[model samples]
Target: MINSKIRFVTALALAASATAVYSHGDVAPQEVDTEGLKELPKDEWLSENPYRGNKEAIEIGASAYNQNCARCHGLEAMSGGIAPDLRELTKFDDEYFVNKVRNGVQRNGMTYMPGFEDVMGQEAIWAIRSYIDKRHYEYKDKDLAELYEQAE
Candidate 1:
């Protein structure tokens, strides 16, 4: 019985490791073109999201979030046991978003998230914020039972 229990534990560990390795590719950052977005001052950081309700921005933001954030944050801003559910974020709170993204969370000698300020421009980041905002509004009003039904 002891040997059987040890084998089960070992199998579970191997399965979890394999899943993590397979999903690692989805976590890499990708370049996004913010063509229609208005470029902000390079040295100046805006206090709020500039493209909150713009239709074009919503589209761009959706794509950008999928490319750079979906792996951890989950598809459509849902949390998949790896990262926070961005859908629960305060609506249009650009300051918090910007600061968090610019200076990623780190604690106890471990990096929880990496800073993306150097890799993505303000326009791209704001676009992602816009997408999260949209997703929040989309799912926030749904009944919890409905959500559970949809999940099935």
Candidate 2:
């Protein structure tokens, strides 16, 4: 009787442990609406970012990125070990960005990312790219030595 009771307790503990681990599953992607942004040509793909440096687009992009990408991509696109630092995408053309986001990426048997084409419009994705680009440029342009010297 004691052996049977021990087995039941062990099974219950294992089940609870599994439930806790499963709770940390993938985060759901947030939805973003690209209203108020200029629409791109439907049949044609842009080779370069048209919204680069656009004030309104940058603002919208910041918000959209925080909601949809901040978790994996890191806050301000700096990356937190789970994904690449988006600030390094300074010279990537618009087509590359679009294709990656639309199709996502996988390696071996693991899914690195999930495609957003079905849920997010092109404008929204482009805006996020723009925001990332802006952050990269700003960080690159900063005179770190000067700022450090000023602190003293």
Candidate 3:
């Protein structure tokens, strides 16, 4: 019994160590590749984001949001149940929000929310993001340039 317990502990330790291991030859940290820009924590996502303050994109996002996410995330990005308020997604970066939407069920989505990557294209996700940002933060065409400058 003691031998088995020791082996179990050893295996668990090894697995954790292996997962944490990173190398430049393997996978280095991800950086923004847009316009020869380097990514800061706050503004990195805005690098490739054409939807940051695009009105048409927000409208499309609203359509997608209403069609798919309104049930749980609420209409206009508000939330009342198991899901978090999507209006808050504006507060998060592109990668974090994208992963959550794509990994819907796995990341606390119930039967109501579905991973939308298949049905919606990348533009749709950005649209949703744009809408959420404007609605939640009162963003506008003029404020967008400065939005990228603000720190978290």
Candidate 4:
């Protein structure tokens, strides 16, 4: 039994390590411009646009945030459920926020969010994030800060 267990463990480790993993080395060999890719013009994309910084969009976003995001995320993006607070999305840039929210970070234990590209549309997602930013980070108070740190 012990030998079988050890063999199973070794096989599991090997299988995990043998998976295709990309590093900086993979960039050059694959003709990938890692920096260029990282520096892609997110400002041009709605995902990183900061959502026109308009109050109207924000209000609409707040409604969206409340309706779709509140139950799992929190009352005001504060995050009381299994989901993390959406407020701290400001910690990352537009691309990161957009990609994560849009793509649904499966590795981060989030796969149920469903890609919003078709459903919510890119503009709406950023607006939601922008609203979350204002509520949780931009207009932050003590309680929200504590929540932010908790996520970190």
Candidate 5:
């Protein structure tokens, strides 16, 4: 009886551990389609987002962000404690935004976020930034909690 109980507990523990390990689901980065946006120079990255405030770019960005970033960054650029709230990025300049997205975030040798420079071009990156910027402007006046409540 004692051996059976121990085995049962061990099996339960393994099941819980497996669940936790796979909790995040797929971690693969999805590709962003930047068609209809202007093509940027391939040789050098721009310091500022060229697509900023462009209506078509903003629309494309919304879809790209949802596909690639909404999982961790939260929907509509709001954060759920998993990642930094991207809307707060409005305080920073465009250069900072571009660099961060291209290079991604890393600390203590662990990749917090993977760099997209290899997979995504400047146009797509700028589109995502543009989308984030729009979200920032929309909620800049209202309380963040209010936005969260509205989302629910």
Candidate 6:
């Protein structure tokens, strides 16, 4: 009887653990509302982020990033070893950043990241980049509060 009970408990534990491990992957991607951002040409994808230092975009991007990216990228663009630290991407040009986000990373028949191009538009992507730029500045020991001032 005790052996059967132990087996039942072990099965329950495994089931719970599996749920925890796979829950994040099952989450549906949330839509970001880029209402106030300037509309970009739908056909022509800009190589550089036009909203790089825009304050409004940064605010919207923060919310968007938390909703869409925080699960894997960690809170505030920090990585918990699950994904690449987005702050490090600040060193690369905007073109490289956009391309990665648009195309995503895959290796050996495994998808490390999914492309957001279909779900997220250019404004949303650039806004997220702006927020990451802010996080990068903060990560580098720069004053967070003065980031916009410096940009100006």
Per-model TM-score, in order, reads 0.79, 0.72, 0.54, 0.54, 0.77, 0.85
Best by TM-score: 6
Per model, how many backbone clashes are there? 0, 0, 0, 0, 0, 0
lDDT of 2 by residue, 87-144 (tens): 8886456677778887888799778988888777778888887787678777789543
Give lDDT tens digits, candidate 5, residues 1-152. Answer: 99999999999999999997787667676688888888899999988767767777888889988877888899898999999898887635789878877899999999988888887888898888888877887868745443233221
Better candidate number, 1 or 4, judged by lDDT: 1
Model 6 Cα lDDT, one tens digit per residue, 1-152:
99999999999999999998887774566789999899999998999778877799999999989988999999999999999999987635789988988888899999988888988999999899999989998889877666676332
Residues 56-138, model 1: lDDT tens digits: 67789899888888877888988988888888876546798888887887989898888888888888888888777778767
Give the clashing pairs for model 1.
none
Q: Which stretches of candidate 5 lie over 4 Å from their true place?
A: 1-25, 142-152
Q: Model 6: which residue pairs collide?
A: none
Name model 4 segments beyond 4 Å from true: 1-44, 108-110, 142-152
lDDT of each: 0.79, 0.77, 0.58, 0.56, 0.81, 0.86
Point out the higher-scoring one by lDDT: 2 or 6.
6
Q: For this target, which candidate reaches the highest lDDT against the unseen true structure?
A: 6
lDDT of 3 at 85: 70
How does candidate 5 fare on TM-score?
A: 0.77
Query: For model 4, what is the error of residue 52's alpha carbon versus the real structure, in angstroms, after optimal superposition?
Result: 4.9
How well is each residue in 37-110 modelled by candidate 3, as lDDT tens digits? 22224323332456566556666767766666665676677677658876555554677777666555553544
User: By lDDT, is 3 or 4 better?
Assistant: 3
Which residue pairs in candidate 3 have backbone atoms (N, alpha carbon, C) closer than 3 angstroms, thus clashing?
none
- Evaluated against the true structure, the overall lDDT of model 4 is 0.56
- In candidate 3, stretches whose alpha carbon ends up further than 4 angstroms from where it belongs are 1-48, 107-112, 139-152
